[model samples]
Target: MPAPERLLPYWTIAVPPLALTVHFLLHSSAGPAAAAVLVAALLGAVLSAVHHAEVVARRVGEPFGAVLLALAVTVIELGLIVSIMFGGQPEPTLLRDTIHATVVLVLHGVAGLCIVVGAIRHREQDFSTRGAQAYLTVLLPMVALTLVLPNFTTSLPGPYYTATQLAFVSASCLVLWLAFTFVQTVRHREYFLPLPATTADEAPSPAAVAPARPPGRQSLAALALLLLALAAVVLLAKDVSPYLQSLVTKAGAPAALVGVIVAAIVLMPEGMTAVRAAKKNQLQTSINLALGSGVASIGLTVPAVSLVAWWTHTPVALGVTPGGAVLLGLSFLMAILTYGNGRASLLSGVVHLILLATWLFLIVVP
Candidate 1:
């Protein structure tokens, strides 16, 4: 059994529920200052929950661990998006903007930071090229078909999809995503595994490596906590949305700024974990987390929101603006180059960060 102190982190599991109850009881009359404090507390609780999820991921091991982390974070992202969508008058463009922002954040911002930090520290970090190729192969087309093609299609007036197109496209995305999931978890799992170290010095330290087997009871507890935390986040997100929206509005920020903030909040835990893995020279794990989260955000989120839109008779737009399309294309090209050689350098990181900056700039300027 692990030491008792090692389990101290589990105490955080109670925070989300407590925070949610308190917010519900108090938020109706809470002023802006009080709301701000509540938002901070909620964000902190979410981060703590994310930490617990990371601990669980470590115990689960490899490809599965990455998948678990991706799913956990994606759930948070989807929950927030869904809650906001249903909370008030639906913003037709909100889903599109949020999805676009999420892809950029994960594929560019988070991934870039990880690569830069890893490259600067290790000088060069290597990961499985096959793994990246698999991700891009599915990701590029999905992004193009879902986010880009909608603008060009005559099947729908404006950049919006008709019911038929939405159904078809949503189903296609889900199918493709499911197929990719099977490959990652089953067919070619080895492709995602870390490459063998070339020398003893390159090998991970004993303490840094995962155990041969994780404790079952501990794993179960962690899983329970993860689910509870996610539920709390979703439940509380409805209350948090108004404060987030007001903050952006008061600053005279672009409407898309809301999407960016939501994406950043949802990606925080996964991004930190990925960056830490990169710093440890576990670039493969970092790559998996970054790309996997991006994939899940798009693949899972679009279909989900589509279903909701259909049920509610809400208008859903999936197309990127012309400027967004161009930026998205550039980001795809950058990702291809970044992962092309199975190695990353500071230059690669810089290019991605530049693209991320462009995306953010366009949100405000365009």
Candidate 2:
């Protein structure tokens, strides 16, 4: 049996159901003040669910842990996107903007923070060059084909892909993502493992060491709870969608802001895990979490959304704006430079962070 302290994370199991009930009972009739309160409550639920996800990840280990976190976040992100996509008023650019924002957030925001913090503490951190190369190999082409190429495609009108192009792009992304998953988890799993400590001083702290997997029952319980918590997040996102739409419309905020917000919310668990790993000089884990989430976001989310668009006969935009395309290209370039040499430094982190900030600034000005 788990300790009392360990069981605390299970509280997330209750959050979603409770939040869902509350939203259904009161959200429609609630005033702005109540809505604000509901939002805060839902946000807390998201954070709590993220905490539970981290606990579960720690029990699983390595590339699998990162993969689990990515899938969980992706599920929540997909729920939010689909909810909004089907919600009031058509926003054709919503999916594209959200995917673009997700890429930027993972590649630059989360990855940059990890690199900066790790480099500042450790001077430099070592990871597998092969792992980084593999990620970029799949990620670069995935982004270019799905996001950039659409802008220039003569077959489509105004960054919009025809049914044939969309089907091809969707299938291509799904296959590439599956190929990368096979390599990461099966064939080349060792590539993502943390480097051995060279000197006595470089040894990982106790907390940094991989924890033993919990017993089978406990692990199963954790998995069940994770699914429940994820379900709650999706339900809560649905409740929040109306408010978000209202706010965006009234405030005249850029549609990209919604994507950024959703990306940040979904990425929270993995982001926390990545930063912690980086701080402990576990750069490989950080890279895995950071880049893996990016890959999954594009690989999985794009296809799911595209299919939904097709089913509903909604006009979907898959291409980036000119400025978005340029920023994404730069982000990809910086990622290569940062991880090209099998090591990371403060400068690399700084470069990526600057790119992230530029992307954020453009949301308002663009």
Each model's lDDT comes to: 0.79, 0.80
Candidate 1 deviates by what RMSD? 2.3
Tens-place lDDT per residue, model 1, 1-366, is 454337536457667667667577756755787677667756766786676677687787755765676677767887778877667645577788887888898788989999999998999988989999999998888888778888888966767889989888888878887788889978998888778777788898666654444467766777776777777787677777777777778889877787788788888877898999999888988888788877887777888888888999988877888888888888888888889899999999988998899888877777
lDDT of 2 at 266: 71
- The local lDDT score (0 to 100) that residue 210 gets in candidate 1 is 44
Per-residue accuracy of model 2 over 156-206 as CA lDDT, tens digit each? 676888988998999999999888988988899887778889999988776
TM-score quality measure for candidate 1: 0.92
Scored by TM-score, the top model is: 1
Candidate 2 global lDDT: 0.80
- TM-scores, in order shown? 0.92, 0.91
Clashes of each: 0, 0
